[model samples]
Target: MPIIIQPAEASHVLPITELVNLFAAENLMLPRTEESVRQTLADWLVAVDPDAQPDDPPILACGALVPLTETLVELRSLAVHPSQQGKGLGGHMVNHLVQMARERGYHQICALTLREQFFVRLGFEPVDRWSISPKVWQACIYCPKFHRCDEVAVIMNLVENPQAAVHPLARPAGWNTLLKWSEWQPLRLAYKQKQAQVQ
Candidate 1:
């Protein structure tokens, strides 16, 4: 059977959500809301089952590329249904997203993921999580495990020329020092202490 890759339609929302949430349940990825998926539908791509009957399922796999900055985009919600795994569907979706990023003139694409090998297999290199833009951490601050984030940052440069240099998030101008996870240990301890005092 042929798998067609195309822009996700409105009907794909539920299947995409269900596929992604399966990984979310295992903490492999973050859970996504249907509303959020709808808002960024344009960024999503889906693989469809070509030979299904009328009442059969429509989408087979899905993924999206979310712009994080003018030159950077984050690949989000990459999910392949259980039945569709190991068939190159995930790689196909990644290739589609990378192509889209290149088309939009993005310099780099990054993913904060536990699946480091998977991203590396797709040409992404491991990078320090602290090297990513601060905007990437905005959502992390609200997460329960903010201080103990386990995801690693992986990045792929889309452009041929080295125009924009990647900046380290912790060393923003006027900041005292470049604080990475290890260096932030004291800060996390202080935060916990402060929270204890408030309680």
Candidate 2:
């Protein structure tokens, strides 16, 4: 199938939500509602058959870049229809999102995913989940799996050599490490408090 990648349209809201929630049903990803998809439609891209009708394109795959901080963005709601899974549609969509991130001036793109190797194969390196503390505070804190998240954090540095710009969580020394460590401490304390409350 010839695939065309483009920004999502208003018509894509339902299909995008359905596609993402399909994986969420399996606990593989977060569920999205039509309203949520509509709100972030501009940040999302959908893969479709170029020959399809404009009013109801079949979304083969979809993903979005969600701004998390000044220099960071999270890759979210990446889903590929079952029929297109092994045909590289997901990878293609991800590459498109990465390019969009670079063009938008984001220093880094990260994702918390169960498919660590999938992102790793695309140049993302595994990092400690706590490394992206903003994500933890903004979303993970409210997740039911906060205390036992099974996902791995993976990052791709868009502006510099990833090796030289290693995330602080993966490095043990330096001021950056100190800052990240300081940031992580309070979160750890908060987690302990939340755990105590739950018990």
Tell me, by TM-score, which candidate is best. Answer: 2
- Model 2 C-alpha lDDT per residue in residues 1-199, reported as the tens digit of each score: 5789999999889999999989888878777889988988999999999776766447889999998666678998899988788888889999999999999987878889989999989988777666574434454666667668899878887876332222355465421221132345646665775677679
Name every residue pair that clashes in candidate 2: none
Give the TM-score of each candidate. 0.78, 0.80
Kindly give the stretch of ten consecutive residues in candidate 2 with the minimal lDDT sum: 174-183
Residue-by-residue lDDT tens digits, candidate 1, 45-156: 9998778778766678889988766887888888888878898889989999899889988888888887899988999877767655555665556555667889988888
- In candidate 1, stretches whose alpha carbon ends up further than 4 angstroms from where it belongs are 54-56, 142-145, 165-199
For model 2, how big is the CA root-mean-square deviation? Answer: 5.4
Which candidate comes out best when scored by lDDT? 2
